[model samples]
Target chain A: MSAAPPVIDRLRARIGTPGPPTTAVVEAGHLKAFAEAIGDSYPRWLTEAPPTFLVALAPVTAHLPEAEEYGKGWLNGGNRFEYLEPVKVGDAITAIGKLVDVYEKTGSSGNLLFIIFETEYFNRHGRTVARLRGTAIRR
Target chain B: MNIEPGHELPDLIKHPTTRQLVQYAGAQGDFYEIHYDQEFARSVGLPGVILHGLLKAAFLGQLVTDWLGERGTLKSFEVSYRGIDVPGRPYRCRGRVTSVVGGRAELEVWGEDPEGNRTTVGTAVVELTA
Candidate 1:
């Protein structure tokens, strides 16, 4: 079998590169929209953000320029999330992210390249609201 | 809610449609074609337009929050995507309390298809008020 592609190495080299952070207010409308998008009709979201709503920060958290190139057929491996504080509507959120790691594995199916990254969301008062570590897989 | 070890939380079922995917794409800024365009999804070796993995994870998170009610806080949650699921099918999110110590409850949560195949598996911890 052939060796892993060179792109995998390029991704590995970018580890620790920080993505440009994004800032947005935790609006009730967006929260409601997200809840509705997931078919959730719970009333709690009217005033407070949903538990996983912070995943919307993907654009900021996953802003690596090289990531767009690997987007062709990549898959979301998964995510680990930790919630630190309740996000109320009208709070401002800033998401900062960086590429953590990249590696390859030769499994039963074939060769798979993985990218591991992390992001943190902070509130207006500079308190941590949530943290996320994610993985993207390319085969 | 009287959550105790071994108690199964209420199941949260979802019926995802392509329209919902579009709505999510707009709301979350994740306009990946594979999540809303059938042709693109097929080109990517998928059955059809698939739901966002984050959306599925959100459903599982909702399961915990809904069970915990207003007084609980989500401390941590994790999930690994095991399979791809297309829109237009019913997906179920369920969780069972593994332990309740002090003011925290630990749960084993997952999402599955109608066939009962696990697609997303993970665990979560919720801090409950005394």
Candidate 2:
């Protein structure tokens, strides 16, 4: 009998080049809720969500249908973001994500799959708001 | 408030859990199961649900912002994910002043677990005034 393929193989098969983009409009309620939840009482964040909050609004690899099918062995590897402007309340934002890379590695815990995705956020005027590079690991 | 070059900021502890992950997901509008669903996380090969990257980064940002007080502004911040912030781990967010010039300060920041495992490493620049 053949052994199962590595997690990387499963991820590659599941996550293709990229698919249609998923977008969400930023709402004041969302910002306020986020600030309150995080216990961030700063006026800037409490009054309105910061541009970095756009990361929450932006599309992520975990959102991919394959992500759910991939199962519970995944973890948030890390993320990087470049904020262009302060995100204000009631701003309708749209985000787009694409698979950037996928590879496998051997660690003490066993085999792990590293997945990278790039997401871009745009405001209502179609202006670029921020860019995020998110990484996830599947063991 | 006066922050000199090489000044270090007090560390803040982040005790992550499945419930906090869910709260962060809901608060940040991130419904990604990897954050709250251990089953799904395991399906993906993770030991359990993990904290969000932004949440970790935010903790670092908070350290700088809090030190700078209400009158300061975060001009820019950036960080690289160094390791997994496994749920239930005791994590510490710390920062050290790198430079202070022209009324602006820059700091090197990072978060680590109780075991000294680095989770997130980054830099932040802030403008301070009286």
Candidate 3:
């Protein structure tokens, strides 16, 4: 008998479907820890949210157990961030993530599954703050 | 500031460590074992707990921001991870102006491993403040 529909196909079914909106506040404490972790000592980072700080605000994509079954491990293929407005401390930001695309590619070692997800960030004022697109790979 | 193509941004070198990886994992709320758990990383065909692509993207972001430094605002930035890098090594960040037009500048940025491999590659677009 054929194996249960491959996990890649299972993941493909989720494209264009948004998960849920996650709301979070840009806290100063969290921003400090993130800059410290990155070892970036820029003084302004203490108050302003650095370029990647938004990812720290929320998960870009929901966890999919099915995708985990396909590969032994996961890799971050890439990420793109578009800033509409400055994200600063004390801004209440909400993030909504959705899978944009999923496909498979044959690499030298083996086959790889690529999942593309897009997330849009909005502040309490209802203005879009930033947009993030990331590619997660399973190999 | 006179911006021209081929101008290099000052380099920012980052020394990454396993401990920082854990710290970043907590800060980002990404608990994926591949980033902090060496055993799990090995199981997944990786050399060891590797740097997060977003972390590298952060480094490149700093590269542009440091150069722009109130001179402009970053409009967009992008990065693609081409290879895996482990901790305990210095990651070199570099960039150059690719073009500038109508008060907007485009830059080519990258992060290099010890051997000079462009493990993380990306670009940034910025609007220079008048």
* Candidate of highest TM-score: 3
Error of 2 at A2 (Å): 16
Give DockQ per model, in order.
0.81, 0.45, 0.91
Worst 10 residues of 2 chain A by lDDT: A62-71
lDDT digits (tens) for residues B1-130 of candidate 3: 5789989999999998999999999999889898989888888778889999888888899889999998999999999999988999999999999999999999999999999999999999999998
Q: Is candidate 1 or candidate 2 better by TM-score?
A: 1
Per-residue CA lDDT of candidate 2, range B1-130, in tens?
A: 4688878898777676777777788877677687887787777666777778878887787777777766666776777777777777777889998998888888899999888977789888777765
User: Model 2 off-target regions past 4 Å?
Assistant: A1-23, A62-72, B1-4, B14-18, B31-50, B69-76, B80-90, B100-105, B126-130
Q: Model 3 segments beyond 4 Å from truth?
A: A1-3
Q: Model 1 segments beyond 4 Å from truth?
A: A1-5, A58-61, A65-72
- Candidate 3, residue B129: the lDDT equals 91
For candidate 2, the lDDT comes to: 0.72
TM-score of chain A of each: 0.85, 0.78, 0.95
Candidates 1 and 2 compared: the better one by lDDT is 1
Clashes of each: 0, 17, 0
Interface RMSD of each: 1.2, 2.6, 0.7
